[model samples]
Target: MINNSSHVNWRPTADIQSLRQRAVIIANIRQFFALRNVLEVETPCLSNATVSDLHMRAFCTQFNDPMSPQQKTLYLQTSPEYAMKRLLCAGSGAIYQIAKAFRNEEAGKYHNPEFTMLEWYRPDFDHVQLMNELDELVQQIVGCEPSNRMTYQQSFKEHLSLDPLSASLEELQKRGCALGYEHICRDEQDKDTILQLLFSHEIEPNIAKQRPCFIYDFPASQAALARINLQDQRVAERFELYYKGIELANGFHELANVSEQRQRFDADNAQRRAFDLPPVVTDEFFLAALESGLPNCAGVAVGIDRLIMLALNKTKIAQVIAFNYQNA
Candidate 1:
């Protein structure tokens, strides 16, 4: 992790010309929202609750009072999701936030410990509408061509020739072994993990290297906070946008069912216990808002750093940032 005391010579992540070009993209994005009537909003950086996704780890900190030696637990929010949803419940119409978010132990060509996120929510819009908006926005910003939509199942079939949701553990293991995958975890791995392995190893790399692709309709177990399709209960209304093999954004058909949300949170906490990670407190305020009803909406979180990297044609995520991990 980068700190403020480093003496190493470091350079900005992107070249000045490229960075300036990306600034235009940022401006275009804001203008797109402004024209759509989506209110640009801001929320707290510190929150008492963290995301309940088992794979998402929050950075926890302690606050001590000068008068006493007691410390209070606080966490750097991974995203502005929960707070934004609460505002939606309070009748805050379509909203968007371009903010900096922090995550521990993530530093790579596509990831950073501290990075910018462009998150937005659309009230009364479902996953399909959200996908259209994403495509239009990307095209407007980068002058990229229109994007194509494919379900997760379709992507798997097109690349791996396997039906991810129906594939058995033995079948997955056989495919992995054929591909020379080591440390087979078929017995412990779920459908999502199995599909993810194949997707990363064989499928994703070959997709629209220069164009944007929208992959949607994930399996129910992998939905995270999204709602499952009532018509096809096996799949959830979730989508992820990929460009040049880099994930740019993730979106979901918002799940406002408080009971189901609670169930998912409990399951995540249980997994955290199994993994020996500290338990995260549930956000009762967010739950109250959920209970009050969240509009049938779709929301997305986009990685600003990766967007800049792609726009600048930079090879590393560190190039866009002022300081990198080794320098900081």
Candidate 2:
């Protein structure tokens, strides 16, 4: 019932040749996992609970329970993380999943509301060991060399001549102002927010310009699900991979303490409430699994579309995605 003119824009964003190349890359990913004995996993795309991260928003829907004749709200999963961790707790060992994840209010040259995520968990591996494996995977996928690893503080010091951890709020604000983010209200922002603004505006653009790089040991306040470093309580054992100034992956030494996890979730919800955003319900099942005991593991989530973009030398994420959100 639609006109041909209107249908003209319905074509896929990626050409057939590009899609074929994408398929080969995906196959390579599966092969890489198979060679490492990591089990492939599949989790439900819908869940009764969603992440409490204040920065992330989940899509919601209602499920009509025929047996109870009631409607129950469900959320499209932001990632397969919660379910995958539950599996790990249930003795699935090392596992990986290439999942289609959804997030609300995300669409741009580098983002889509729906995109593929490559997530994995490795039991008995610390963040460093996981980073080694990640390096190998990236090299195999893109023929890129292994990356240099640096601490978050070191990166800031090297690039901006400021030690992020030791810098005062005023110093950070001054750095932000110097980086052309002078419009950012300094009085209302916390140290973490100011550091984030400075990093995004100044340091991040220059990182990994020559090759891929991993920045680790983030400030405790910026740790999402990472455990605090016992050696340095001020820092968390988290790392993010960047290639050509584009963020490619985020990983953490998984926080195993249930109480600490609960506190972090509560804090995130409180921040959401302060911002006048609806607070999300925390996943009780995930928490229970953690309480039962999750093994020492490190996990990482990679953006597949971005990886494809880098591999194929494409500029925009749409060049790798079959159909962007606008067309979808």
Candidate 3:
């Protein structure tokens, strides 16, 4: 951590020109939402509840009040999904937010421990329709080619000649090991995780490096908050948009069933227990909002730093942001 005692230069990671360019792109993004009449809103960045998704982790902090006897623990939100959904339940029409989000144990060329997130929810829109909107956003901002859609299963087969949906654990492991991942494969036992590893390592990098690609219909188990497809229960209505090997956005055809949502959260905790990872408390307030009935909607969270990186042709996420996590 760069603190008072640390001998580090106190300067912006991005140059003056990059900061100005970033400002312009963000201005245009706000205009894009304004033209579409999407209501811009803000939500509390710190909350009592954190995401229970198996792969997500929130930064924990303490809120100490001088008058209170206890210090309450609060979590830095990983995304604005829960709070935004509550707004939707409260009848906030189509909404959007450009906010700061934090995630633990994330820092690299493409990610930072803290980053900017542009999230939006569109009532009455399904994942497909949202993809169209997202494509327009990327094209207008980043000038990428028209996007393409490939299902989760099709992407695997097209790239590696493997069927991710039906492949058994042993089969998947064999394929992964064949791709020179035997060392990493030995420690991983989860099938969904293995598929993801293979995809990120081998498949994603080789996709259209310049154009946007949308891959949807992920395995049901991989669905964090997406609704299962009626046509094919084997997959969920989740979609991800990628450009130049970097995932730009993750969108879901929202799931509104309170009971099913609870079940999924429970399953995630159970898996955490099995993996020796600490379980997290589900957000009951969000559950109550779900019970109150969330209108049909499609929502997506976009990595604003990544989009800026693409627009400016910068290689590292640190090149576009004012301060990387290290400096912050």
lDDT of each: 0.85, 0.91, 0.93
> To one decimal, what is the Cα RMSD in angstroms of model 1 from the true structure?
3.2
By lDDT, the candidates rank as: 3, 2, 1
- Can you tell me which runs of candidate 1 are displaced by over 4 Å? 1-7, 65-69
For candidate 1, lDDT tens digit of each residue in 51-123?
8777777788987857668887788989999999999999999999998898886677778878889999998
**Model 3 misplacement above 4 A:** 1-7, 66-68
lDDT of 3 at 65: 69
Q: Any runs in candidate 2 off by more than 4 Å, and if so which?
A: 1-7
Worst 10 residues of 1 by lDDT: 182-191
Cα displacement (angstroms), candidate 3, residue 143, comes to 1.2
Error in Å for residue 178 of model 3? 1.3
How do the candidates rank by TM-score, highest first? 2, 3, 1
With a 3 Å backbone cut-off (N, CA, C), the pairs that clash in candidate 1 are 2-328, 3-328, 13-319, 13-320, 14-319
Give one digit per residue, the lDDT tens place, for model 3 in 1-328: 6567557678999999999999999999999999999999999999998988778778999999687899988999999999999999999989999999999976999999899999999999999999999999999999878998899999999998999889999998898888899987766788988899988998889876768999999999888999999999999999999898899999999999999999999998998888788999889999999999999999999999999999999999999999998888
> How many Å off is the CA of 105 in candidate 1?
3.1
Each prediction's TM-score versus the true structure? 0.93, 0.96, 0.96
lDDT of 2 by residue, 1-328 (tens): 8668865677899998999999999999999999999999999999999999877889999888897778999999999999999999999999999999999975887889999999999999999999999999988887788898899999888889999889888888887877777788356367888888777777789888777999999999988999999999999999999998789999999999999999999999999999899888889999999998999999999999999999999988999888998888
